[model samples]
Target: MYIEYIAMELPRKLIGSLSQFWKINVLDIKQLYDSVEKLVFVSISLEKRKTDVVRSRYNSTMRVPKALNPRLQKQLLLRFGVYETVYPVETTPSRTVPDHIEKPEYVLQKQPTVLPDKAEVKDVNQLRGMRRSCKLAANILAHVQKNIYPGITTDDIDGMVHKLTVEAGAYPSPLHYKGFPKSVCTSVNNVAVHGIPDLRPLRDGDIINVDITVSLITVITLCWHQYVNSLQNNAIKTCGPEVPFSEIGASIFRHSKRNGLTVLPAFIGHGIGRYFHGPPDIYHTLNRYRGRMRPGMTFTIEPVLSHGSKHTLILPDGWTVVTEDGARSAQAEHTVLVTEDGAEILTK
Candidate 1:
């Protein structure tokens, strides 16, 4: 277990580079009320070029970046591992933005993808099996939530969760999905959703949520894009696209993006079965996700609820997401099996 724990910390080393080159500051622009665009890289992938073997190795005396939030910065230091580490690069006027991203088209958008229809389930027996898997996964998450407290880094929580999942013969589903570097979702205040787990620790007033999904290669991509378009349609109705950009727009757009980053807060959760992303898409905000809950269908119901406005900050890493307002956030998830009568929380 100790050796395995060491292996998981390897990825943070790459993410840690961001803080090394930049100093974080709140500066104002001469003309506008807002300041110059704050650039911070929140993601780094050694597997970008090579996926098979763990490529980069750092020495023992490595330094982690100071998170904008102080408690989180300390937590990251304790969570460094063989796979990753959290590097903070504070940016100042003296620093230079990387020229490698030369094109305007290189922008990254926050969006969620639409999942294909879930496969048909034959009967209750199959649903029961799926329920068991989800239940087990949920229990693991519960363990994670209980263990993760103020002063614990996100990476520490990830390490603990990864160990527990492997011990139960399950894999951390988020570890390598399209090269996502972590095992779990760690959304702090303002991070609407899809916040990568890091060395950052929970704070006294922080409300964080960790969405738990199973590790299934056979399962379709859990985050479906349809959810985003539906929400965007809702946004347009509530306020026309011509509406001025405010902090509120930030929150709305984060959830409305077609990518999987912003998950529905209210209508989150689903049934898991042979199809990991089954019918009856859990609407985050009373919206329609289409499909029905059938017996033998299993899915996750992990919603990323936030505080106040929905605007979010995308770490330069492009994956570690945070809320723009810095308000606290919280989430709870469980896989369920559609039974003859109702639903069963599998990850309890």
Candidate 2:
């Protein structure tokens, strides 16, 4: 009756603060709803297998807010059947990265090898390089974001990013990082992070995260003037040096009582320079242990916020991560330099 469906699915930590505004129901991923309902899709939680409170493993859950009309609820129950405590599961498919492009450390290694470096500040030259690479990443995302209207496939986004990154003489940072298959990360609604861009098409009212990580060690010095100058000017003007691609989802749901954007604060925005991902792991949300930003520092401030529960599930592929509740999510990231007074957005 009230705006009970407003908040996007968030983690338990934020539920206390947000629960006062909305009520929640946990549904499975296979339980499709009318895509017509704007904010009806999201990932949440529940006790699966009859009181066995299992978090996502094979079957994923999505947070469906109670604020939706009775018609929606009836449709969900009908398709999904009794909110089955014993959830029927399905196998998640996987993909591959092309051999022509360069890959990061994680692809060969069984696990992610990038770590945060503890150094407080970077040198002047280091800042310049970081700025250039971040600019490339921002530009790639900007181009991908433009093509993100309904009817476009997430895979199409990947193709565009790959072409742009290669044409710029830079590498798509995420392509083979930890065996991730795509050039850019395209997280459609209900997915948290690492949503592999595939055949899924974008829909109106749906949200997505197009995360572009670029390795510009070569590209920056070669001819950044061509790629960086054109898009760089526009990105700063529109997003104000903020990562616009990442902000789309959060902006869509920010003030909605029925749908909120829940970003992942646990994932650290690492220092990006010579190495694609390294130390000084920055916790995007609130944290007491991390150090303060200092001059010459270079790192990312990318937050992957979802439209549903903050809880997440890793797909069978091991590289792709999705919101456990099966909701829409987006990530906005920027490589920032700590200047004398404040910070500069390298990805601006």
- For residues 1-348, write the lDDT of model 1, one tens digit per residue: 000011122244443553543343323212211332333323333324321111121121233433457686555435421122222222112111233322111112224334445535546565445555555665776577568677987667667766775565555566655556666666654455666776555566454566555543223223211123344334323322222213223444456354423343433444444443445455444443344444454555444543233444455556655443343344544444445555444455
lDDT of 1 at 281: 50
Predicted structure 2, TM vs. truth: 0.60
Candidate 2: tens digits of C-alpha lDDT, residues 120-217: 36666766666676666766666665677888877777778778877766677676555666666665555556667777566655556667667665
Give me the candidate number with maximum TM-score: 2
Report every candidate's CA lDDT. Answer: 0.44, 0.51
Question: Candidate 2, which segments miss by more than 4 Å at Cα?
Answer: 1-63, 66-117, 218-263
* Cα lDDT for residue 125, candidate 1: 61
**Candidate 2 weakest lDDT stretch, 10 residues:** 219-228
